[model samples]
Target: MWGLQPFYIPWYWYPCSTVFGSFFERWPLNKLELGMPRLGLLHTGIVLLLTLITELFLKQLGLDLFTTTTGPTFAAIWTTVGLGFVWQFNMWPFTELSQPTKGIVASIASLIISVFLYLVTVFLVGQENIIQGLYWWFNILWVQVFLMAPGLYDGISLWQDVPPLVEEQQPLSLNSEGR
Candidate 1:
């Protein structure tokens, strides 16, 4: 199951291997925003196409369509998630993302949040047995590969526009009417 197929890999996903390309062109590792990804109509269509192509490729690679039983299929999802995070980090391997302590704290926090969200989504989707496993696969692979990538990029770009943090004073007490 670990064998790499000799077929040509998809062009779009390959750019993740490069440093500058991955940071600017691919999805950022941390998801900073908490709402709908700002994909326009044309971008949405492209992402859907890319996701379908990736799913088909995974199916071709012998991933189980029925995920009811716990086996290689479920294991693959965990493996991919780990690999994805590692790969994203590798994009800046020689450089520090931030101070070591801050980076470690952020990394640990992000991992916890990611795990909690996955469990929540699976429960909310009403997935059970094999379907739950499939949902994991879909979310780990296609969702990140396509949907999250574009959305994350938009978020990072938008973040630049946010005003800097400023300290403001607050009144001690107030009344409904004049006081």
Candidate 2:
């Protein structure tokens, strides 16, 4: 577990591996190695993205995302939400993007999804019990969401619906002589 500083992180997901990290990092350095500016611009851009997302709650005062709070807890929730999308799900709708771009876009997309989720939760749970409702959402319900989201997007169920094994069939012998 390295420090893996993400400007705004060490990382993990329900299904996680260094393969995702390596793919994004090694490729960027080899392909888009723009000196230290790469670090500066990339990091700064992501930080700004975080700030902008946070502003959605901070500015509104009363509004907040699916996250617990609009501070560090918000960052934690955003990271948790993005991991399943970014890693297990292969950053859908942005998979064609380069590694750096994919990471950035998918992250912001996750934050957007969080906002959407907040609205949904509020509508369903109502404002009266928001704190308890969000707690249930992030802690309990999101586990199932993480497990299924990728499969749902990819048109598969994690527990695939297929036979476990197939019986071997004898090969048909062709009689070319008859033809």
Candidate 3:
């Protein structure tokens, strides 16, 4: 258990720095890729384990894991994983199914969904411990979003590989040419 209190220390700094820094800059961290299918799962396990450890650390620091407000935090994590497949495919927003857009939409959509779910969870659970719950939720989801970043980008990039929707040229008939 980490000795630091839940809100006493700057919790966001470590997770935020680790999350974004490792994600975009690829700075001070591991390169997790969906291409390595086996390794990807292993990496996911490692991340989830670390999250549990952090929560336990917070608990050791006297933070209650089951407080009503924290319920939404837990829900956000569940939401992230639930949306993983759709996010990776850039398949949200049914209206844009035919559009050739990048995976940026998926990431943004995922974030919005996560936030919405968190709020809903908090509303159902209670607002007293919402901050604590959000703290945990965001930390875990941050890593999830980071891990999914590559796959999501790949899905978007995959669109570029597709040929343009141009009109097909007709083949001339052999008989017509002879005639």
Candidate 4:
């Protein structure tokens, strides 16, 4: 269950970027040409996989690192590092910014967001209410879906009808006048 926590945050963060970007015409993964929600799901899936693997590795190493006091902090740091790499590798390459500028900005932004989320989680879901607090956090994350309304509305208006594919003709005609 703890392994699943990191997965929830990205669902909120990415869609927020997407919904907001739709209004401003600025998207995070613009090169992919995918909907922001779709990108968010992909991002969440990747983060979840990495987080679970890292957790398992730590457990195997007998680190005993995820005490209540350390668990959120570790989660935040892991989230920051994971997202920084993801944005740098996946989104940054497609942007107009220079490599160093993009890398530094992305790193700092990821760290800030991770720390903010961590602090908010800690405040709202104090140590005694760990499970309950996580539940609330998950609930808050889902609120991001509401941000998709404008994008969805615009998409509805911009919907296009695609023509059906025509079947290919045989190379040789069955009833040719010339042999």
lDDT of each: 0.41, 0.49, 0.47, 0.45
Model 3, position 161, has a per-residue lDDT of: 59
Measured by TM-score, the strongest candidate is: 2
Instruction: Report residue 94 deviation for candidate 1 (angstroms).
Output: 9.1
The candidate, 3 or 4, that scores higher on TM-score is 4
Best-first order by lDDT: 2, 3, 4, 1
lDDT of 3 by residue, 5-40 (tens): 343222322332233222223211234444567754
In the order shown, the candidates' Cα RMSDs to the true structure are 13.5, 10.4, 12.0, 12.9
For residue 137, give model 2's deviation from the true position in Å: 2.7
Q: TM-score of each candidate? A: 0.31, 0.43, 0.31, 0.34
Model 2 CA deviation exceeding 4 Å by range: 1-53, 56-77, 141-179
> Mind giving the per-residue lDDT tens digits that candidate 1 earns over 146-179?
6444433331244566787886866556786536
* Residues 1-179, model 4: lDDT tens digits: 76753434333344233322322233234456787789768756644554455446545633223444334443434343333334323433424655445544654455456556655665776756656655554444345334322333331113344555787875785676634
Error of 2 at 3 (Å): 34
Clashes of each: 2, 0, 0, 0
When summed lDDT is taken over every stretch of 10 residues in candidate 3, the lowest stretch is 20-29
